[model samples]
Target: MSVISAIFVVLITILMPPAGVFAISGCSVDFFVNICLTLLGYLPGHIHAFYLEYVYYDRKEQNRLGRFAARPAPGVYSDRIQSGGQGYGTIVEDPLVQSEEGRAGATGQ
Candidate 1:
């Protein structure tokens, strides 16, 4: 995330805890739950916001590392070549023959 976004998230979490959690989670259930917690008390809302932040960062890091690990290395060719194999040959079928056969079958001949 950008520095601006990080600062915005921190500010929102501290000032408006429930909204921060909702923005991070983007889940209706989490949003409503955080709102309820905030209504009950500020501490609960802050705690939940921190938890959401931790989860978000954890998942983000995991995705970044996963993508890095999954990429092929430089100068690597991944395709495999078939050895001593005859390349593909076209098998042709006449459309006129197929149509005539269809007509004969339709006429019960």
Candidate 2:
């Protein structure tokens, strides 16, 4: 999250504790619960808010990394061009592949 958003959340929590907690949790829980928690103790509400933020950010980061890891590496193809073959076909030449091909051609391989 940006610093502005962090500051905004902190300010909201300090000014209107219950609303801040509710917003931080994406309103997944009852507003009354937040109100009760805030009423019980300001620190408890802040703690819950921080916990929710931690979980939210952690999950977001995990999802991003998961997506990145799920993608095929550059110059690698998902489908084989020839059926029943274990080798991958070169639809587009990677820089390494291009250089290797050039060397092979020069060597008459």
Candidate 3:
């Protein structure tokens, strides 16, 4: 459950950065829903609906989405969140508290 939702969230985060924060915030919901679907794989949950809702909100509120999305420039939070460059991690470290800017500047650009 957690594992599957984590996978989905990670995928979404990679494709669309905003989803990462949303997924981190809504980890519990995703985990539970994924668990339910896993237990009932034959009649699994409507993931399309979920994706639609997520996408709609993400696009509709681009400003807020920007705030939620990963920064094009690297930051302390990104460094902590990234797991060996693979983007694996269930826990979302506090974005506000991160202070180091890493060896590379911004996106290494």
- In terms of TM-score, the best-performing candidate is 1
| Candidate 2: regions farther than 4 A off | 1-3, 67-109
* Decoy 1 TM-score against native: 0.55
Ranking by lDDT: 1, 2, 3
lDDT of 3 by residue, 1-109 (tens): 6447656765765454434544543443444444455456522333522443354344334533344445432321232122212224665666554433443355683
* Model 1, span 1-109: residue lDDT tens: 4447657877899999877766665555667778888999999878876766655554445545542223422321211101101122744466799999999999999
- lDDT (0 to 1) per candidate: 0.59, 0.52, 0.42
Candidate 2: pairs in clash: none
- Residue 83 accuracy (lDDT) in model 3: 23
What would the TM-scores of all predictions be? 0.55, 0.46, 0.26
- Cα RMSD (angstroms) for every candidate in the order listed: 19.2, 15.1, 13.8
In lDDT terms, which candidate is top? 1
By descending TM-score, how would the candidates be arranged? Answer: 1, 2, 3
Which residue pairs collide, candidate 1? none
Error of 1 at 34 (Å): 0.4
